[model samples]
Target: MATINNTPAKPEPVLSAFIKAKCPRCRRGDIFASPTYSLSGQKMHETCSHCGLHYEREPGYWYVAMFVSYAFNVAEMVTVAVGTYILTGSNSPWLYVSLLLGIIFLLSPFNYRYSRVALLYWLTPGLNFEPWRSADKPENPQQH
Candidate 1:
């Protein structure tokens, strides 16, 4: 008789895992407690449900996500401005201002959600996907 391991036969792809907002380490458990556009507002799980990896590495870790959010905002603003100019060719400042403001308002949630996701996925130095953690059952499931 052969023994079966708990690990997944094939691990999930990085991009798919990131888009689904799975835990950076486990890639099986969700990172966010609530949906991106939830009425109650987005909520994040403190730790990975599968592997028990803490979401926040240390105190004030999330503050760094603010800078990530800021970068997202600037990129979004520039894209909107350039796109508006190309499509409308308007010299009016009001048009640009109004469009930019509307865009910022509309995309705030997206920026908020993705900034943190980006931070966990790319910016954090040590955190990386562990294929073994994506198993059907974690070796030890206690929250870290």
Candidate 2:
């Protein structure tokens, strides 16, 4: 004769989950199947493991992510360029070019992984965090 606890589970913070690259809806399952900097390159799960949300909502959905990635690249380049200028105070064009190129190459993986995450998390209008999906046990994990 045991009684069950009826309280709902606590939901994860949006910012924390976003940084961790968790499913936008459940914030439990991982969005990317592989690590960001893996040798095999980043691999994203087709659907959320917890809530089974299809990652690509429709045909050409991921094309939108290209724009997001471009924005991330631009912001990163600007920040790095400004930081390098302030730190070195160098007027050499080659210094700027080499440093910028190197930095962009290193950060490409990060940009690729987060761009899709950003698309799903913020750009998609209909998708939002569903508290019920974040339960310790999802009602139907394969429903997507």
Candidate 3:
């Protein structure tokens, strides 16, 4: 006869999972249908593979992702500007703008997916780094 181990499993980090495009709830499901860039652009899964978390909250839920995308764009611009200034000691405004534009254009697809993932993680109230594995029923079961 064998005894079973009852120790709970370690939960995956939410930030790391988001960066890897995994579901915020279980941290194991793949958020995107395609691993990388796709011919038809980035395709996202409707629901989590491991858990039953729905991707879309409502019709215009993804509009919030636009703000997240804007934030990412601004950050990317600042980073590129600083990097270019450091690499080439020429403090030209044109150079900074050109490099920023190039970098943004190159990373457009990444920005789109990242923004969506960020919003998904943020919009879900009470989301934790640890997996939400409670046996208790929610206050409102109908509001998923």
Instruction: Give the alpha-carbon lDDT of every model.
Output: 0.87, 0.87, 0.74
Q: Write the per-residue lDDT of candidate 3 for residues 18-90, one digit (tens) a residue.
A: 7898877667778898855667888889987766678888798889888888999998888877777788888
lDDT of 2 by residue, 1-144 (tens): 111495446777999999899999988889988988998888889988877888899999999999999999899889989998999999999998998899889998999988999999999999999877787665654676
Q: What tens-digit string does per-residue lDDT give for candidate 1 at 92-143?
A: 9999999999999999999998889999999999898876677776554456
- How far out, in Å, is residue 18 in model 2? 0.6
TM-score of each: 0.90, 0.89, 0.76
What's model 1's lDDT at 4? 61
Model 2: residue 60 alpha-carbon error in angstroms: 1.1
- TM-score computed on alpha carbons, candidate 3: 0.76
Candidate 1 backbone collisions, by pair:
none
- Candidate 1 lDDT score relative to the true structure: 0.87
